[model samples]
Target chain A: MELSARNSLAGTVKAVKLGEVMAEVIIQVGENEIVAVITRSSAERLKLSVGDRVFAVVKATEVMVAK
Target chain B: MELSARNSLAGTVKAVKLGEVMAEVIIQVGENEIVAVITRSSAERLKLSVGDRVFAVVKATEVMVAK
Candidate 1:
């Protein structure tokens, strides 16, 4: 599916940590690892697992810059 | 200042498009340009302009993933 979010880094799932309500997904994008905190329901719906390929999606508005 | 958000990509401000209440900031990070939409007040507070160095900050909770 097409996404409006600008940044979409393709990576493999390195780890998945499920909390009571939130789920932490660690993705290895080249040398950098991106950490994503999503809803547990979303994680369950996605059925994410280790070694699976995924794209970290972030909306442009959610991004902030520090000088 | 240190941030909890993992992704802090260093870049230079390429352009700033201000709207009535929102602002769009385009940052040149390496060969990729990241677009950020922020509040007009925040943009004014930062006094962001062209060629300024900045870091694109995104929180883990705000990040999503797609298979």
Candidate 2:
């Protein structure tokens, strides 16, 4: 599917932890490990595995910084 | 709006560059400035401007890393 976000990083699924309402997915991109939290239903729909390849689409408004 | 992916960052709109089909939005989150490219239509719908508060939503499968 087409996404609006352009920061598509190619990484492998390092780990996944499913919760009742949410799922924590850890992706290893380059030398950096990016973590994402998503709905458990979405995770199940993707059938995410330990070695699955995925893109972390980030679309946010307020990225809080130390001001 | 509620999103399926989590990883919400509270950031400020640092800059916005609109393109024909897409818009580049730079958000300063903590010490890092996360960049997100989204559809111009979406950006316009959100009325994204400098100093706007937003959250970056990321959802991907293959986060490519050096293998």
Candidate 3:
């Protein structure tokens, strides 16, 4: 995924579950885990799997940085 | 949230689960559903719920339009 927001976190694909037309892709970024649900058709094309490198893109305007 | 890619899909919040510091927000966009994870602080401030309108922003470099 091409995100304009500056994201710099990488993780390994921990699991993937195919849904109707989308697939839930889970990745472990450091100590945190995040999920990305993409179309099943896309999953098949990407051939994603566990142990594969993936990214968790996050963009929030209200990123309140607590001091 | 700010995204450079153009995305135009709206949905109603379905569920939310608070994690260590993030909250899993689920939204039903028509027949499809997507998840967005934001800091717990954001969720609380937003006051997200099962009836609020939200947008799902998706940007795939390989957004292949199969003919």
Candidate 4:
């Protein structure tokens, strides 16, 4: 079963910063970007690698795409 | 200004389905849900009302959250 916090971004893993037990991920969606804070375990599970094409799904009550 | 699938989801507005102009949003981050397809004038310029609680962003690569 998936948790409530489950949304996704399909793009290139432009960058990755592992910190403590959480990692800061930056996914490039076209010319825009999506930022996600994930746990080390999840990061490893995704086997996320720089330049890798992956989705960063996040379930948060705070999505605001604006102009 | 922002545009690029953007990427966001603060929750509520549990459901919305317009058409053509591309509007079919379902934002419920706490209970697993964040699907976006906007254009119908931003579902009324985010003035969207359906237990309104704005935030539904997406930039467009693909985000993946697993079990």
Best by DockQ: 1
- Evaluate residue A45 in candidate 3 and report its C-alpha lDDT on the 0 to 100 scale: 71
Off by over 4 Å in 3: A1-3, A62-67, B1-67
Model 1 residue B6 lDDT score: 83
- What tens digits encode model 2's per-residue C-alpha lDDT throughout A1-67? 6664444556688998999998888876555567877778878888887898887555443222221
lDDT of 1 by residue, A6-66 (tens): 8877889999999999999999876567799999999999999999999888899889979
Best model per TM-score = 1
What tens-digit string does per-residue lDDT give for candidate 3 at B1-67?
Answer: 2222335478888998998777898889999988777767767777777898877666554256878
Cα error, candidate 1, residue B58 (Å):
1.3
Worst-scoring 10-residue span by lDDT in model 3 chain B: B1-10
DockQ (C-alpha based) per candidate is 0.66, 0.10, 0.04, 0.18
Candidate 4 segments whose C-alpha is farther than 4 A from its true place: A1-7, A59-67, B1-46, B49-67
Ranking by lDDT: 1, 3, 2, 4
TM-score per candidate, chains pooled: 0.81, 0.50, 0.44, 0.49
Clashes per prediction? Answer: 0, 34, 2, 27
Q: What does chain B score (TM) in every candidate? A: 0.89, 0.82, 0.73, 0.28
Candidate 3 chain A TM-score vs. reference chain A = 0.75
What is the C-alpha local distance difference test score of each model? 0.88, 0.65, 0.71, 0.62
How good is the docking of model 2, as DockQ?
0.10
- lDDT, candidate 3, at B28: 95
